[model samples]
Every structure is written in structure tokens, then in C-alpha cells.
Target: MQWAYLLGLVAAATAGHVSIPFSRQDYSASAALVKRQASKDITLEALNNLTGGGYYSEFSIGTPPQKVSFLLDTGSSDTWVNSVDADICNNQQLQATLGTCLTTFNQSNSSTYQLVSSDGFDIKYLDNTEISGDYFNDTVHLGSVSIKNQQLGLALQSVRPTGIMGLGLSANVATREKYKTIVDNLVDQGFIDRAAFSLYLNDLESDSGTVLFGAIDQKKFIGNLSVLPLRPRQLATRSHHSMSGYWALTC
Candidate 1:
């Protein structure tokens, strides 16, 4: 399991749902062809929970299955859920950990549970509290996908939103241990093309959301494009240090 603290950035303003087109009308036929060629079908589903501010979907855990509403986060690695029996007053760290004493989910009782070491980083939140714990390998079910031996962060307490599913392509403890994001795992398993996945987050008070797995709607384009360099794997060197500053900006 991976642990992380909430960064206190003001939530991005919600502008309702805006459809992004894959191409602009002024673009030449060639450009339109290229744009269409790059598109794929991506499937997404809306999720709901009893919690007032629930996101679009429920993530499943354990053999019997404990479902928790979670946000799909690309910026972090690890998945966690709020504990039903969390002791908030006695344990401040429990506040930042998902699946604390208040939730019904119990990891300790799961037969397939195994704990991995934390990276020693004190994950802090806006509440000025930190949580510490080792990662865990377990079965994770998201939407129609079921991934066994998934790496996730299991905290002793519960914090903002019940949980998170990290979808970044970076190689971290979770990824190295064969735990992959839903999209990545799908691509690896040849269920979807590598570049076919795209996320369209519709920030609605009702917690409505959508995702496209194999293709996107053609009518959603506005005709803007920016090409960025994909990172190439290489041995650590002096040159790597120079690029670190730029990489941090993107993150």
C-alpha cells in the first residue's frame, strides 16, 4: 500500500461538463485523419456512496469484497480505504489513513493480506498529521477490471475521500511490485491500446463521472494539440539531475 497526505490546493473550479473535440474544423483533412486515428473507445461509469461528497465509483477489496468510493488519482501511487473503527482522537495519524476505525472494512481479517514496508516518508495533510504503515498486496476490483496481487497503501486511519487509485506510469514500489493502474494493467493485458485511455473528469456536486477506455467521441474536439516528450528509461547520470527540475514541474 502507498501512503500520501492531502495537499491543500484549492479545488479546481468546476465548469460543468465540457466536451473536448479531437480536432478543429479549420484543420486540414490530413490533420483530421491523424486525430481520428489517434482516438479510441474508453468506457467510464458513475459511482455513488452514502457519503455526502462521494466520487463516481466504488473500488472493491478483499476476498469477500469491501467496496469503497474512491477518486482515480494520477499523481500518487497506492490505493487505500477508510477504516470503520478508526480512533480519531487518540490517533491523529488515523485521520490521514483511509479505512480507520470508523469503517466496516477490515484488512486484518483478510486471508490474502501481506504487509510491505513504507518508504519512510512522513505523509502529512492539511490537518498537520502524519500516517505511517507498510504497503500491502491484495486483490483490487475497479469497474469491470479485477487485479490480483495489487499493491496498495493501507493506513490505520481514514482521510479525505474514502480512497484513491493512482494511474500514473511511474515505476514506484506499487508498480515495481506488479501492482498497476487499471488503465496500465488493461494495456499490458492487451485489453486496450497503450494510448487509447483518456479521462474526462466532470466535477458535479452529484458525483457524476465518465471514462473512455478504447475510444473517445469525435464531436468533443476543439482542435488544439501539444506534443510532449515521453520519458526514456536510462541509468542515473549527471544529465538526469538537470532534468529533475523540469520533471518536478510536470508532476
Candidate 2:
């Protein structure tokens, strides 16, 4: 049986390339592609647990690779970084206090950056922190490898000085109106074989952890991983919209 190559990461993204297998099961067409096999788990980078506040990771965006730190949030579906014109970053009071929200993105600096929408991203969280920005597509480097033309948000009116890299569901949320997300591009652009990623946070008292995008570190756990089925989207969404889109185990 032929297997497909896995792409990108959690902490460290892979530097490998993805190629579709030529011969499919359907046997409808001729062998135009090679029988590509799945590559071993590729690593991207490690997550730095900042004194137990939250997990932060480094990502280089744009052509020249401007490094930035974004808090990895799974609760929200939108991934947004502060723009150079971000209100909080420019404001005197909020500027000094914006911990962990460091490094705003500049579109003009990157040669590969492309503007998709002028006002494509606007989101408000449960705490009423509203973020509004333009939609942009650029190259995002997980570690050494790159995911090309990944669409992301550039926040201009954010409360936090730092940015957010949310890995939640990409549809029917704040970002649904915008273009495809990094994760979406990760799969479509052949970064990963499928739409699955594993986050290895290690354990409590661990200062450093890693996020595996398209692969899993089998050595992290011993026993076989148990598969839990998720609740139906329609049933889960019927009660509350907020609780529905996310992955929830059904007993």
C-alpha cells in the first residue's frame, strides 16, 4: 500500500515537500504522478511556555522572514498579527504593557506579500477585545520550511500588543468571510498530507514544548492512542453556536 507524505508542524514545521501519488485506487487515469510515500514525522520548532501564562511560538512571515511571536490559541478560529498601524502598539499606555503581543507585521516590507481584502478581518472575543484588519497572503515559515501564499490577518485595532495565532475551525466564524487560513493553505499547498495536527505540550512544570503540525511524536506517549468520536455538528450547534464548531468528545 502506498502512503502519502505528511507536511509542516506544531513547534517545528518540516522542510520537506509534498507530491501527490500518480496512481490512485480508481485507476481512472494513467500514471502521471509518482507513487509517493509518507515521509517520517517532520519537525518545525518548539513552543516556549512563558512562565505558565500561555504557550508562545516563533513564526517567520513574508519573503525576508520577519520573525514574530504569537500566542497559540485554540479557542478562536481567527489568526491575526498586529500591523505596524495597530492601535495598541501605537498607543502610549498600551504599548509598554503589551506583553507577549510583540512584533507587528509590515506588508510593504515583504516582496511575496499580497493584499487580498482591505477590511476582511474583524473579530471580537468573549471579553470584547475587538480586532479589525486587512487580509493578506504571504509566505509563512514554520521553522526552516515555508508555506507559500498563506492567507492571514493583519490587525490594526487590537487591544493586545502581541498577535494571536488561533488554530480553531476556519469556517462560520470571524474568519469565515476572509480568505483561507494558514492551516487551510498548509493542507492545500501540500505542506501536510491531511488536515490533522498534533500538539505535544509535554506536561506540567515543563518550560518547553513542541507543536507538531502534520505529524505526531509517538515516543511522547506509550499506550496506543484512543480515538474519540466528535459530536455531530448539527446537534452540537443546535444548543449553542459557540459550543458547536469545536471538537468535542461524545460519550
Candidate 3:
């Protein structure tokens, strides 16, 4: 299930790139578009937000007119951006160097902004610096899709680079009430066929990482796989237990 959450984060951050045009002067003509087959390799790129956070499988964000990267974490439930102008705690020194804070979009620019909840979740380090906030409803654009009033986390704090986005199975009341997830938005807009996606995560040092939509890359697996039954209620209960244990150990 943790893998599922991380896969969601990767799916949310995945972006399409235009292939470089080949020249006919020196090289033979080739296909204008390059489609990569799915594999088990972990994709690598500079996740702008994950600078000092750690070496993580990275993906690019194509929204709000900014490039940001993040660690594919499934343990958290909201997404946030770190602000450079906010005050920082002594213990947050390490994260301070990871990435630049985003300041372009603020409350004033969003016309339909609504804060979801205040008592959502909190993350802190031993140095006393922490990040906390609740889910928020706002418009987020990815690729050609513009998700209106989507539920996302907004963090208010002086931290390193861009904030994080949670991809856990646990959903906030508002999120559940509205049935919103990055995948859901994509599906609704017809960018992807379904809410299910697959991630090929390799060792941190490997240069291969990819996310598959609608179908898995058959070559990556040893044999055929079967679909599992949906168990939303059970998944939610397990998420609660796991989160409680994680917070207790970290706090």
C-alpha cells in the first residue's frame, strides 16, 4: 500500500516532454516521437523540492509556471510548498538547502481557494522545525489538464524548497466527500483511462524509473499478474494504524 501511495505521487508529478528534432544533415531520419516502453527502472531527474531532503526517485511538475520535484512519499496525506520568506526553526537547517521556496502563487491570486482542515497532519524534525497544514481546494494544472478546485495540502512555514505532496491511502473528509485525487482528476479529464497507475522503482543509484498509465509494461514482470480485490475500508483502517505508529516513533 505504501508503494501505491508513492506511485500516486509519481503519477501526479509525471510530465510529457517534446523530443528534440533530428537533423537530416548528419544523421538518418528517425521517428519524430519517441515512446519508451515500460520497464522496472527508476526514472531520475532533479526533483527541485527534494534537494536536501534526500536522494529520491524524482519527477517534474508542469503547473503554476514553475518546475518542482519531490520525494515520492506515500506516508503523508497532503502536498505543500516550502516558502523561503517564512521563519525557520533551528533544526530545519538541513532542509533549508534542498530547494528554493516558491512565492509566485499566494492566497490573493486564487479566486476559489478554500482551506480544508487545520488539524490535519504535522511533520517535524528533532531540531524543532516543523511543517503542518490541512488539505485545501484549489485549481491545479498538469500537462493539458486543469483540475478545478482539487484537494491539495498547503504548508505555511519557512522551509527549504517546494513543499511536499502526500500520496497516502488515507483521505481527508473533504477529499473523500469530493472523491478527488491527482489520478482522479486525470481520469475525469480523460488524460488517463483509469485511476490506477504503475511505478517502476529501482535502487536509488539506478538511472531507470518510470510510471505506466492504464497498463503495465509486460516486459518488466517475470510473468502475468492478477488483479486484486478492492478493499477501501480495510485499507483505510490499516493507514490509520500505520500513521499512528510512524508519528509516535518520530515524535
Top candidate when judged by TM-score against the true structure: 2
Better of 1 and 2 by lDDT: 2
Candidate 3 vs. true structure, TM-score: 0.52
TM-score: model 2 vs. ground truth:
0.73
Q: How far is 205's C-alpha from truth in model 3 (Å)?
A: 3.5
What's the lDDT for residue 147 in model 2? 85
Regions of candidate 2 where Cα sits further than 4 Å from its true position: 1-52, 96-101, 176-178, 235-239, 242-244
- Residue 231 lDDT in candidate 3: 35
What lDDT does each candidate get?
0.43, 0.60, 0.41
lDDT of candidate 1 over 1-251, digit per residue (tens): 11111221112212221211111111112334334433532112211111112233556777767776555544444455544443442465533332223333467776776665554222342122344345666776655666576656665544343455554443442324444655555556554444233444333232343554544433333443333344444334443522321112222
Error of 2 at 167 (Å): 0.8
The lDDT-based order of candidates, best leading, equals: 2, 1, 3
What stretches of model 1 exceed 4 Å from their correct place? 1-56, 84-86, 89-104, 118-129, 157-161, 172-183, 201-207, 213-219, 222-227, 231-251
lDDT of 1: 0.43
- Candidate 1's error at 68, in angstroms? 0.9
Total colliding residue pairs, candidate 1: 42
